[model samples]
Target chain A: MPPTSIKSRFGSRIRSLRDDRGFSQEELAERAGLHRNYVGGVERGERNIALENIVKLAKALSIPTRDLFTDFP
Target chain B: MPPTSIKSRFGSRIRSLRDDRGFSQEELAERAGLHRNYVGGVERGERNIALENIVKLAKALSIPTRDLFTDFP
Candidate 1:
């Protein structure tokens, strides 16, 4: 599989989680201490997200880091 | 929590996994297509690893991406 697919998969997962938690991109960005544009790009699979940022997102969403990775093949 | 702590926690988890899988840093680096020095840095908790690289490492380890994060609290 190509790297782009991996990123897109991750982005899709993040979006699903955000939606489940009733958070908009801007809300998630604020909670994660990331820029809204950056969060949007991540959800769009356009950014290669960093670990720290992932951790922030997980914490903001009150979920485990692994939860973001669930259902990924 | 500080970002450095998060990085270190992730590094510790990687090292534990590598040990469990009987992989040297060089071997893991080769498997992940990352630089050996970079893998070493990550193991030492000194690298803010990107998601793409994290996916590479997980794939190389023959494990789910979530497994790398299992013990992190």
Candidate 2:
């Protein structure tokens, strides 16, 4: 099995959680205090998320920061 | 209850993990491809960690990146 890339792993996990929470990308971005384009890049695995942003996402979701970084499957 | 600050949470988590592995700050920094000063700042809750660096640290520790972001009770 191929080792999962961090970008893909992070992207899929965030997208899944966002969808589960009924948040559109733009909505999530607003909550996380990030740009919509940046959020799109992250969901598409095109950008590297920063730790500060991760914290923001966690706070916005009312979850632990680890929730954003979880490995799916 | 006072909400734990993100800097403190992240700093403590990384320090605990590093200590558990018996790696010095310098050694961990080398493994994570970050500067010693940067790692020190992180451990001291004085730096904002980036996602790429988070990935690097996780890979160095042989743990999932989310492991670094966990909230310790």
RMSD of each: 2.5, 2.9
Q: Candidate 2 chain A — worst ten consecutive residues by lDDT sum? A: A64-73
lDDT of 1: 0.89
Q: Please, what are the lDDT tens digits per residue for candidate 2 over residues A1-73?
A: 9986677778787888899899999999999889989988888878777677777777766787777766632
- Per-prediction DockQ: 0.76, 0.49
**Candidate No. with top TM-score:** 1
In model 2, the Cα lDDT at residue A19 comes to 91
For candidate 2 chain B, the 10 contiguous residues with the lowest summed lDDT are B64-73
Tens digits of per-residue lDDT, candidate 1, B16-70, equal 8899999999999999999999999998889999998999999988899998888
Tens-place lDDT per residue, model 1, A1-73, is: 5554877888898898899999999999999999999999999989889998988989988999998898664
